[model samples]
Target chain A: MRSSFVSFTLNGEEKELLIAPGQRLVDVLREQCGAMGTRNGCGQGGCGACTVHVDAVPMLSCLVLAELAEGCDILTIEGAARDRTLHALQEAFVAEAATQCGFCTAGMIMAAKALLDRDPAPQREAVVEALSGNVCRCTGYEPIIAAVLAAAAMLARLPAAAA
Target chain B: MTRLRGRGISAVNYPTGMNLGGDPSQALIHATTTGNFVVTLSSVDLGQGLRTIMTQIAAEVLGVPPESVIIDTADTDTGPHCMGTFASRATHRIGNAIIMAATEARNALLDVAGEELEVAAADLETDGDGRIAVKGVPGKSISVLDAALAAHFKYGRTISGRGIYLKPRSYPDFETGAMDPDSCQAHACTIAEVEVDTETGEVRVLKLTSAYEIGRALNPMMVEQQIVGGSWMGMSHALYETTEPYYPDRAHGPVDFAEYLMPGPADIPQYDAVILERPSASGPFGAKGIGEMTANSPIPAIANAIFDACGVRIDELPITPEKLLRALDAAAVAPRR
Candidate 1:
C-alpha cells in the first residue's frame, strides 16, 4: 500500500501524522494518534464505538478513510473534559449509572455530545433517535436516555459562560 | 387481521457458584504507611464493578471510608489465586474472602493502635474517619496513619491479612437422590408481552417486567443494569440472534457486526425490574452471585408469549419468521392472504 501524510486538529491540538493509503481513520487515530479512548468495537461502521467529532459532526471513524481526515478538526472522548472537570454529559452518566461496562461509553458520550450540541434541550424520543446507532449491551438503554435528559437539564441550569 | 397480543410469565431458580471440586476464591488486604487499605484479588472485574464492590466490603470491615481503600485486581503476580470469574461467583465467593481478610486487617490495625495508645486492642474501634478511638471515649483516639507508621517502624509488624472461602463439593446420597450441590440459590420471574403479526409472521416484544430475589443487592444500580441487559439478551436469543441460520452449510457465518444479528435501539422493549433482598446464610454481607440468571428467564417467557399469541410453539432459538410462518400454517392460525 501507499503511504499518506495527514494533518488534523485533534482535541484542539494540532497534529500531523503519517498514514498508509486506505487506512481507516479509526485505526490511524488509535494506532498513531494514541487516541486510545476512541475504542474500536466492531471495526466496521455497524458498531458506533469509534465515533469522533470531525468538524463538529459525529462521524464513524471506522468507515472514513484516513486520507479523508486531512486538515479536518477531530475531537475524541479525551477532549470531552475541560481542565480537570468532566463534561456535563460525563457527570450525568456517572450520576445516573449509565456507564456500566464503559466499552460503549466513549462513543455513546460522543454521540450524546453531538446531540446536546445540536439541540441543547432534546426531548426523550429525540435523545433515543440520536443515540440509535450507539449500542450499549448494558443498562438496556433505559439509564442512557435518562442521562441525556439529565445532562440537558444540567446544561440548561448552567450560566451562559460555563456552558 | 389485527395483531394478536399475549402475555406469558416464567420463573426459575438459579444456583450461585459452580461447585466443581469445591469452588473457592481468595482475597488479601494490607495497609500502607498512610493507612490506605489495599485489597488484592486475582478475580477480574470484567466491567461488572467487582473492584468497587470489593472495596466497599473491605472499607466496611476496616471501618474506613471507601476512598481510603483501594482495590488492586491488576497483576496476578501480586494477587492471591482465584478460581477465575464465572458462575456469577465473584461477589458471593470473593466478597466473603475479602470480609474475612479485612476483618483480620482491622484487628491488626486496632491492635497496633491499642499498643500505641496504651489501651487494650479490644477497647479500640475505628471511627470511620481515619482514627481509632477507645470504646465510649471519643476524645482519646489515634490516627490510623500514625499507628500504621508505628507498626512498620517501631513494632516491626506487618498489618496484613489473608482470607479464602470455599463451598466444598458435596456428593449425592444415591439411595435417596438427595444432594446439596450449591451454597445458595436465587429466584427470578419475568413477564413478557408481545405482539405477533399473522400476515408477516413478525413478532415484536412490547415490554418485559421482571422480579429478582437476589440474596442482597450490594449495589442496586449495578444490579438493575445487569437485569435489564440480561433480559435484552434473552429477547435477542428468543427472536433475533443466530450464528448459524443455515447450519452445516458453514458458508454463511457472520464475519463481523454487519452480518451478525442483534437487537438495536429501535428493537428494544420497555424494561421494568424489581429487586427483593433476602440475606443469605453464608453470603458476604448477605450478597449472592446473580450475574447470569437474569438472561435465562426472559427466553422462556418470550417463547411462551409467542405461543399464546398464535397457538404455535417455537422451541428453537431465534423463532425466526420462516419457522413461525410454518408453525402458524400447521396450526391453521395463518390468516389467508
Candidate 2:
C-alpha cells in the first residue's frame, strides 16, 4: 500500500496525516484520529452510520477514500459539540429520546445538521429526505423527525451560532 | 388478568418432587456466567429502548435514579447469556428480572429502615427520585443512599439485588406446525395510501397511518422513534431496499448511499402514529415490546395501497418500478375478475 500524506480540516482544526491507499475515511477517522463516535455498521456504506460532512455536504465516509478527502473540510460527530455544550441537534435528540444504543446517533445528527445548515427552515419532507441515508434500528423515525424539526426550530433562533 | 398454562415437552421429564427452593429473593436475581446483571437477551438493539427500560427497572427496584444505573453489552462472556437480538422480548423478560432483583435490594434496605425509623415496612414508600418516605408523614424522608449507608452500618450487609427469568416453554405442536411459543405478542395496524404511475409502474407512498397496541409506552419519545425507524425500514423493505445474493460470497450490495435506494424525503409519505397503551399482565410497568412490529405492516399495506391506486397486486417485497411493470404487464393479459 502506498502511504500518502493527507491534510484536512476536521471539525475545525487543521490536521495532516498519512493514509494508505484504499483506506476508508471511516477507518482513518476511527483508527487514526480516535473518533469512535463515527460508527461503521455496514462497511459497504449501505448504512449511514459512517456519514460525515465533507466540505459541508453529508457524504458516506466508508465509501470515500482517505486520499480523496485530503484538503477538504470534514466534520465528525466528535466535533458537533462546541466546548462542553452539545450541538442543538444532539440536545434535541436527547430531549426527543431519539437515541437507544447511540451507535447511529452521530451520523444521524450529522445528516440532519447538514440539512439544517443548508436550509435553516427545512420542511418535514426535507428533513426526512436528508436523513434517509442514515439507518437507525432504534427510535423508528418519529422522535428522530421530531428531533430534527425541533433542532431546526432551535437553530433558527440562533442566527449568530455556527451550525 | 388471565393466566394461560400449558405442559412443556422435555427429553427428560423431571418429577415435581425435585428439590427446588422457591424464595422471592433468590428467584429474582438474574446472574450471567460472569455474575453481573443479565437484563437483555439480545445483542442487537434494533431501537426498542430495552437498555433504558432495563436501567429504569433496575434503578426503580434498587431505589436509585434511572441515570445511576449502567448497562454493559460489550462482550457475551462477561455478561449474562443472551439469545441474541430479535422478537422484542428484552424489555419484557430482562426488565422483569432487573425489577425483581432491584425490589429485593429495596426490601433489604427497607428491613433496616423499619428498625431505624420505628415504622412498619408497609408504611414506607420510595419516590421517583429514590427517596424513601414514611406514609402519612409529609416531611419525614430518607434518601436511598442514606438508607444504604445506615443498613450497611447496622447489619453489615450491602444493598443489592439480582434476578434471572426463563419464560415457560410453549412450542408448536408436532402434528400441526402452530406456534404460540412467543413469550409476548404485540399487534399493530397500518394503512397506506399511494399514487402509482401507469406507464412506468412507479408507486409513491402518499401517507401511512399506523396504530399499535404496545401494552404501555414507558417513554413516549423513545416509542415514537422506535415506530418511525421501524416504519422506514419496512418502507425500504417494501418499496426500495434489497440484498442481492451472489453464490460463493455476497458482494457489496447497496455499497454506497447513492446506489442504495432507500426512501428519501420525497419518497416517504406523511406519518401518523397512534400508540395504543394496554398494560400487559406480566410486563414491568405493563410494558410490551415495539421494535419489530413496524416492519410487519408495510408490505401488505403498500400492496393494498397499490391496488387502490391502480388495479395491480404485487406480492413480493421491494415492489420496485421494474417489478411493478412486470406485474402490470401480467395483469393486462390476465382476465379481470
Candidate 1 local lDDT, B123-228, one digit each (tens): 9988787889999999999998999999999999989989999989888898997888788999999999999998888889999999999999999988988898
TM-score of chain B of 2: 0.78
Model 1 DockQ class: medium
Q: In model 2 chain B, which range of ten residues has the least summed lDDT? A: B9-18
Backbone clash total, candidate 1: 0
Best by DockQ: 1
Model 1, A6-98: lDDT tens per residue? 899999999878888889988888888888999898877887899999999999999999898889999999999989889999999999888
In the order shown, the candidates' DockQ scores are 0.68, 0.47
lDDT of 1 at B131: 88
TM-score of 1: 0.96
Provide the lowest-lDDT 10-residue window in model 1 chain B.
B328-337
Provide the fnat value for model 1, as a fraction from 0 to 1. 0.60
